[model samples]
Target chain A: MSALRRVVRAFPSLLRVGLAEMVAYRAEVIVWILTSTLPLVMLAVWDRVAQDGAVQGFGQGDFARYFAVALVVRQLTGTWVVWELNQQIRTGSLSAALLKPTHPLAWFAAESLATMPIRAVVLIPLIAVIALWRPEMGVGFEPANAPAFVLSVLLAFGVHFLVQTIFGCLAFWLDQSLGLFNVWFAVWALFSGYIAPIALMPDGLRAAVEWLPFRALLGIPVEIGAGLATGPAVWSGLLVQLSWLASCAVLAAFVWRRGVLRYGAVGA
Target chain B: MSGRAFRAILAQWRAAWMAALQYRSNFLADTLVTALWVGWTIVPLWFVFHRAPERLAGWSYDESLLVTGFFMMLQGVLEALIEPNLRGLVEHVRHGTLDFVLLKPVDSQVLVSFGRVVPAKAMLSVGGLVVVLVGIARLPVAPDLGALLVAPVLLMAGLAALYGLWLLVVSTSFWFVRVDNLSYLLTSILDAGRWPMGLYRPALRAILTFVVPVGIMTTWPALALRGLMRPTDVAVSLTIAATMLVTSRLVWRRAVASYTSASS
Candidate 1:
């Protein structure tokens, strides 16, 4: 109870610092968001493929919707905590973070959330382009499922944050966990609907990907945003996403404790 | 081109090689990451093309693979030979280290361009070559000796155009303090080059060919290797490459003249 109170108390300050940092690195943040342009590239290819006829129920219109939403979802939920945590761990700056009363993850979460506004700057133009140019992409609001969509996007953000933090903690033992992250990113590019809509994937592959966290992190919100998954589908997806989130949070906490122990043993 | 400059460039490469050797584990890890990236790119080609009966924007599956190979090879060369150096140019300019590099007897442009060569990163090109060979073997007829000879020449021309494009981006550091973000624009543009330029609309295709020349750097080489390129196309591509190179040199000279050291 006290710990929870403490983190809640620290939130505002942490967020303030995070916002300052974001402003300082505004150009970098824009570049980072812009570099998530693979979806646009994929959109072009998929758009071309759908030119002749629909592929797996995805017409060119559907491709535009899927990829545009995918880009928005990706930019919103993407986590760079692995890179931050890895650098801190490697450089021994984590020791300072450990000295803080609140958990370091709380600070990371604050930093991640704080940068969203700047990231949203990039998304506005995309939203404008999509809204003005390709209004038929069907990315508008659904009042009925709006709650579910928001919940899914929020949970997706949580899931990615936890997953990246878990991977970041691997820096305690590994030479460079970012390399492993590259491997994860490569796989996620295929499975997470960044490259293609999961619905358009082969049956076997789609079935296999459904249970993975990558799909929950990117594909679900995108599906919901596009109005593909609704009612029971959205409910079941939220349940699975919640479970994954819980598992990752527990795992991250466990790893942080163990990593701190190891850090202590090394006398850092 | 002078012997002294050649020795200086060789010494820079030696330093780069030794630095790369020092991080063998990181090198191996990078190699694996790049290989997985290759798979990441190829699987999409299979997913998109296999589902449809028609050629994607006029390129067949095997032909698409050849484009993919050229994309990988060109990207690998840029990653190994060019990116590490050019990506840091903005930083050097910002930190005022470029002033010392300019003060050196060697040509600043040559030193900056040829300074870093990571043998491990070049493994991406080796991997790309394997893909290219596999793509060639998959074709109905092997490339004739003339086509084989033509491929490397076109490949060099493509590389020159790409370097010219990169130089155009990096040269902006003289006026723009935060031009590092500009590199992201370059990569984003190049990502479109992974496929044939014909896949894009006419306007985009023209931009990719004439403005960025990603088509010349990637598609032309792949086409030459596959014996699909025409004499006129090859001549046009070489002309674009030379023009871009000359223009970039002119821009570099102008940018350098205007450079004011950040330390000052």
Candidate 2:
């Protein structure tokens, strides 16, 4: 409880420092944002595939809308904390964060969130251009699912952050944890509806993926935002997603505690 | 090139090889990762084809594998050769450590371009060929003598063009503080080349084919192998690739001159 209080109190200053760090590395931040444009590339391929009439009940508009919403959701939820953790640990710079008064995880959280302003600056124009040029893409607000979509996105961000932190903690012991993370990412890419919509997935894969946490982090919010999910579907997805949030939170706390205990920093 | 220049380049690569040998585990891990990545690259296609529209703009499942195989080979070259060198070039520029490199006796372009290599990453090209063979096995007709001959040529040309494109991206750092993001953006955009060019809308198709030429780099070669490409396309792809190479080299020279322009 006291740790939570310290984290909350320190967060604003942490965020401010993180924002300054982001400004200094603003170009690299743009690169990070641009790399997530994989969704747009997939959008192009799937949009063309859908031109042959509805496959699994998704027309060109449906494909475009799903991917457009997906782009926003991806940018909102994404962070490369795992890669950063690996680099910091390897270079021994993580010692500074360890020396901080607050929990080091608070600083990581701030570092991840501070990139939001730049994302918004870049995405607003992008979304506006898409809205204007391809109104048929229907990149817009969904009033009914809007409130739930917001809640789901925030929870999804929590899941993504915690999951990266859990894997990031692996750097304390592993020679290179990024390789292990790649295996997870490869699975996530397949099951998270990254290449194609989950609705279009084969029956067996869809059935399995629906219960998994992979989709909870990305696909659910995208589905809600694209108007694919209704009242019950949205709530049920949020239910599954909330459980992932809780599970990952517990796992991350445990893993980080264990990893930090064994951590030996060789720094000046 | 003179034998002495050739020897200097060889020595640079040798040093890089010895440096890489210092990290022995990376070789084993990276080779394993490359092999896994080869299989994972096919999974998306598996999902897309799990149902049946039969073809992606007339590309059958086995045929699409040819394109994916070629794309994998290109990524192998990118990781093994292009990215490591470009990264070194950019870091040198950013940190102003480039002065040490500039003081060297050898040609700076050769020094930077062949400056770093990850030989382990080239294992992906070997893995890519296995995929190509797997793709060829399921074909309705075996690849002919001409295809057997032409595929490797296009692969080399595609690699040359890939380096040129990366070189072009890195050249901008000479003027702009950082255009490293542009290289990353180019990489993600090139992800589109994994599919048939016909799978894109016309506007994007033209851009990828000519403007960026990623389609020419990967898909045109695959098409040539299948005997599906026009004879003129071979000439055009080779010509365009050569043109991009020469143009980027010229641009690089001009960019390098600017770096020295202020100091003089």
Candidate 3:
């Protein structure tokens, strides 16, 4: 309750700083958005492949909708805080955060949230393009599913942020967490549908990826957005997401406390 | 032209080496990171071959491995030399540190291009070479000595092409200081080079080979390993690399001449 109160108190300042930083990096943000055209390239390739015959369950139109939604979903759920936190901890700049009254997680969350407004600007055009190019492909924003979808997105963000923080905290124990982060990212890229849909994976791998948290982080929201999943699958996926979120949140908080202690002892 | 310039270059290299030594642990981590990246490339081939153990895009699994191995080697070289040095050009240009670099008696371009040598990345390059050698040994049709000879030449051309591309991007900082993220754009495009260019659509293949020229950096060396290089492809790749290098040099000179530091 006290942590929540502190976050509430510091939220405005955090948002202000985040917005300023976002504005300062506006050109970079634009370039980042533009550089996310990999999904579009994949979409083109898959669509061509499905031009003559469907690949498994995906037709050309399905490929278009899948990749387009995947792109948007990736943008929404992306968390690069691991890189920031790792750099800060390694350089001992995280001490600055420890001195703050508010929890560091609150500050990071605020910064991540602040970037959403700018992201919405990029997302709007992408939505327009999707609407124009593939209007028939939507999963339908049903009233019942809307709340669940929103909840899933939030839970996904929680998992992503917490996992990144865990990796960041590894810097206290290890010399550099970048290699671990790279390995994790490679797993995420392959299993999380960042490169391709988990559904498109070979049966055994698809089954394995489905059980993993990576798919819950990226693919589920995409699947929800595409209206490909519903009912029990949605609830079960949400349950899994929440479970992972809770576990990661606990792990991150625990590791962070210990890591900070170590940093203090080492006088870095 | 002067002995002083040579001394300055050597001094810079020594300084970079000493700095890298201070964080020796990071060297191991970076090497592991490169190894993981190399592993990432091989996984896709494993899956592709598991599905159909013959070939992809008209090349056997071993050939694909050759492509990936050569690309990794070339990428290691770029990261070791050009990337670490010129990556900071935007920050230097923004902060007016370029003036200090310019005031030196040495050729600024050469200095800027080789200012920092990432020791960890040099290790990664050695790793990439080992991967290439192992891959060659496993090939059904053994590569001849000529292929091995041409490999380094092609790799050098590829590295020059990449450095030229990066220099062009870095020079944009003179006009737009916010283009630091342009390196991210370059890396993402290079990621596409991990696969054979033949797998892409004709238009995309053309763009990757000619416009981006990533195919020349990665695929040509792999093709050489397979003894598939026609004289025409070799000539075109060399021409492209040379053209890009000259063009980037011209652009760099012009950008520097026109640069009015942000501090002013």
Candidate 4:
């Protein structure tokens, strides 16, 4: 009860700091969104190819819609905290967070959540563009699926955040955790449907990717948004997402415990 | 004039090298990061080959690997020298550090252009070149001595063109304080340079050559490696690089002239 009370008390201050940092780096955020334009470019190229004939299951319109949805999903879910956490842990500035009464994960979560307003502003326009420009690709706003999609997004964010925090915790052991983070990101890019849909991948690779947690991170939400999966599939994907989220949470907490014990506060 | 510039250049290089050695582990970590990144890039190609097992845009899988390898090399060089140095322009302008750069006796452009060398980035480029050589050995066509000799020259020209393009982007910081995002805008466009330009529609191919010139930095070199370049393309690429370098220099001067320090 006391721990819950402490979190409630610290929430306001945490948010204030997160907002300040976000505003200070507003230009960078804007640049990051603009730079994530690869999907759009790919969309153009793939749409052209699909004009000749459908490539696999995707027609010209489907390609346009899929990749356009990819742009929005990628932007909304992306996090750079692996780099930030690695830097803080390596430099021993993580001690500052440790000194605070609140849980460090809470602080991390707050900081990530604080950036949502700005991202929302960016996403709204993109959602509008997708809706207005690509009408054919629009999923009917089924009330039942809305709850599932929302749940999936929350789970996606949780899985992604926890996984990154785990990577960040590696800085305590290794001198540089960002390298591991890079490899993770490359894998995420390929398996999470950032590069292309898993459906388009070769049979063997696609099968392998399905068994992994990466698809639940970005791909499932995208697929959900496109109305590609429904009913039992959505539930099963969410179950997998929740399982990964739980595992990552456990692993991150375990690493953090060990990492903090060894923490010398050297760089700080 | 040349003597002073030469000394200044050597001093900067020494400083950068020393700074790199201090962070040796970070250097190796970054190199590992680059290798993993290169591997990630290859995965898509691997998948593509698995799907078709045939030539994409008239180039075999091995030939495509050559293109990927060369493109990676060009990218490695950019990340090493130009990208890292110019990346800080926005922060420098915002914080008025541009004034300190201006106060130096050395040319501010040269100082800014050659400021930092991420040692890992150099290693990445070398790793990429190794990949290119490996790909060449696997190819059905054996590149002769002439082609091998021309490779470095073409790579140099590609580097020059890349530097010129980045300078143009960094110079925009003078006008737009938020130009870092614009730099990313450029990067997103450059990502398309990974694939051969011929794979793109003609319209995109034309735009890449004329407007962005990423094609020259990546695709043309790959073509040269495959022994597909005509003398005309080579001459045009070299001319373009020279023209871009001069234009970038002029732009930097003008931008610097308009620089009102952030402190003011």
Candidate 5:
């Protein structure tokens, strides 16, 4: 309880520092932001493929909508915590953070949140463009779906952060957890709908990916944004997302507790 | 190309080799990472082909895989040689170590480009070669001997073009100081090159061909392997490579001249 209180108290200052740090490296951030444009590349490929005829019910317009939504969801929910944590662990600078009364994960969460302003700058314009020009893509500001979309996006961010935290904690046991993170990223790129719509997957692959946390991180929020998810489906998907988030959070905390013990023994 | 410079470069490679040998376990891990990277890139193409009832943008499934294979080879070259060297450039500029590099008797560009090698990353290119061979075997017809001979030359041209592009991107670090993510912009472009160039819109196709030349770097190699490339196409690719090489050299010289050492 006291740790939680301390974190809450420290969050604003951490957020201020994070935002300053992000701005100080704004040139790098701008370059990093372009990495998310891969979906735009996929969009081009799929859009052309669908130009002649629909593929499994996705026409050019559907692909346009799917990839645009993917761009938005991806920008919002992307996590670099694994990389950050892995670096800190490897350098043993994590001890400096360990000395704080507030948890290091809480600081990481704050830094992740700080990047939102810049992300929103890019996202809002995209929302405007989609709303004004390509309304048929169904990405316009619809009031009914707005609440559900917001909730799903939040859960998606949480699930992504917690999952990365769990993986980052693997550094406690491995020489280079970043390698494992790369492996995870490769799998996630396929299953998380970063490359394409999960609905477009073959039934067997789709069935397997749906149960994994990756889908909830990207696919579910994107589906909601496209207005393809609704009512009971929305509620059920949120439940699944929340469940994944809870489990990952628990695993992250458990791993951190054990990992910190190992860190202390190794370093001190 | 002088003997002393060549010997100096060889000595650096020896040092890099010893360093790599000391951390040889990283090779196994790097091999797995390379496989995963290849798989991640290809799976989307597999899904697209599996779900579509017809061919994609006039290319068959196997033809596209050939493009993917070529793209993987380019990525291997990037990861193994280009990215590491360019990253060293960024570190040099940031930490003011470019002074030491400037003091050396050999050409600074050659030293910056080929001085360090991650010997373990040989696995990535080896894996890429395996994929290329597999893609060749899966093709409907064997390539003509002449076309096979031209393919590797064109691939070297492609590598030259990419190195030029990377130089242009990394040269910005002289001014920007902390643009580490700049390499990833090139990477994202390479990612786009994994697909057949014909799949893009005409404007984008033109951009990829003329501006970035990713189309030539990847698609032309695959086309050559399939015995489908024209003589004019090879000429154009070589010209593009030469143009990029000269342009990047000029830009790199100017960028270096503008450098004032870091504040610290």
Candidate 6:
């Protein structure tokens, strides 16, 4: 209870620091954002493929919309927390963080959240230009879906951060959790619709991936924001996101607790 | 190409080999990572092909695998050699560690380029070859012998161009100080290499073939394997490799000359 209160009390300062840090590294952040433009590449290939005809109900415009929104979702949710955590843990600089009055994860979470306002500032104008030019992607921006889309993106971000925290916690036991995270990343890239829309997946694969956290963390917001999902689908998607957000939060806390006990600060 | 340079490079490899041998257990983990990555490489093709009822941009699924295999080989080469060396060069520049290299009595470029070797990454290249062979086996006709011969040479041209590109990017760190993620833009281009060049729009195809030449680097080799390449492309690729290598060398020298040490 006290830890929770302390984190809440400290969050404004933590967020200010995070936002300042992100702003200082703004150029790097933009470059980092641009580096994940694999979806746009996939968008090109798929757009070309769809030019032949709509394949699995996706026309060129649909792909443009899906990928554009997917890019937004990725930029919003992605954080370097795993690398930050893994480095700190491996180098034992995590001890410096451990000495803080509040939990370290709170600061990490603050940093992740801090990237948003700046990213949005960058994203909004791009979104405007893209929407103005290719207005087909302008779907689901209606007030009806806006709140749901917002919530889904936030939950997705939560799930993604917590998942990364869990993986970063693996560094407590494994020598290079980054390798393990690479495996996770590759799988995530496929299942998360980063490479291609999960809608286009074969039925069996889609069925299987639906239960996984990857899609919940990435695809649902894209789907919602792109208007691929309707009223019932939106509610169900939010429910799934909430469940994932809750479960991953628990899992991350559990992993951290267990992992921190094993922290002998080998580097220290 | 000289005997002493060859021996010096050989010694670097020997040290790399012994260092890898010292951590034998990492072999299993490295192999596992390679296996998973290879799966990531192949699985996306399945999804894209599943949607395409017929050939995807004039290439069959089996045929596309050839491109994927070639792409993987280039990727392995990047991960194994170019990325590590150039990334090290960036750090060396940032921290002024290049002074040691400048002091060394050899071609600074050659030493920096070939100094680091990740022997464990050999598995990724081997994995790529296995996929290429598999794709070859599934082909309607055997890949022609002449084509096979040209494939490796073309692949070297591709690799040389990529290495040149990386060197050029590293050279920019002399001014930019932190251009780390800039290299990933090249990587994103390489990621697009998995698909057949025909799959890209004409403008993109032209860009990939002429401007960036990722098509030449990855796709041309696969096309050569299937006896689909124009003889003219081979010349173009070689020209590109030579141009890139020469240009990168000129740029690197200029950058080196202008370099004020970042550290005292």
Q: What would the per-residue lDDT of candidate 6 be over residues A35-70, giving only the tens digit for each residue?
A: 777876788778778877888778777887888888
Question: How high is each candidate's TM-score?
Answer: 0.91, 0.91, 0.83, 0.82, 0.93, 0.94
lDDT of 4 by residue, B95-170 (tens): 9988988888887888788767776777767777877888889978787777776767777887787788889888
| Residues B1-264, model 6: lDDT tens digits | 667667888899899989888888886777677877887799989988888767877789998998898888888888877888888899999899899988887788988888888876767787888898999999888988899899999999988988888899889999998988888777876788888898876877898876677888778998888898888989999999999999999999999999898777
Every model's DockQ: 0.60, 0.59, 0.32, 0.41, 0.75, 0.72
Residue ranges of candidate 1 with Cα displaced over 4 Å:
A131-133, A139-143, A264-268, B14-33, B141-146, B174-178, B258-264
Winner by DockQ:
5
lDDT of 5 by residue, B142-258 (tens): 888897898899889999999999988888889887666877877887778989998887888899988888899889988899888999999999999999999999999999899
> Can you tell me which runs of candidate 3 are displaced by over 4 Å?
A9-17, A35-38, A41-52, A87-101, A124-147, A171-179, A200-211, A259-268, B1-33, B48-56, B130-152, B224-229, B258-264
lDDT of 5 by residue, A75-94 (tens): 88876899898888888889
What DockQ would candidate 4 receive versus the native complex?
0.41
- On TM-score, the leading prediction is 6
Chain A TM-score from candidate 4: 0.90
| lDDT of candidate 4 over A1-268, digit per residue (tens) | 8988999999999999988888888877766766777776666545544555667867666766677767766766666668777788777787887888898778888888777778877777766765675576554434566678778888888888888888888888885878668677778878888767778888888899999989989888777766667888888888888888898889988998898898778666
**Docking quality class, candidate 2:** medium
- For model 2, the DockQ equals 0.59
For candidate 3, give the lDDT of residue A43.
64
Name every residue pair that clashes in candidate 1: none
RMSD of 1: 2.9
- Superpose all Cα atoms of candidate 5 onto the true structure and report the RMSD in Å to 1 decimal: 2.5
TM-score for the A-chain in each candidate structure: 0.94, 0.94, 0.91, 0.90, 0.92, 0.94
Alpha-carbon error at A138 in model 6, in Å? 3.8
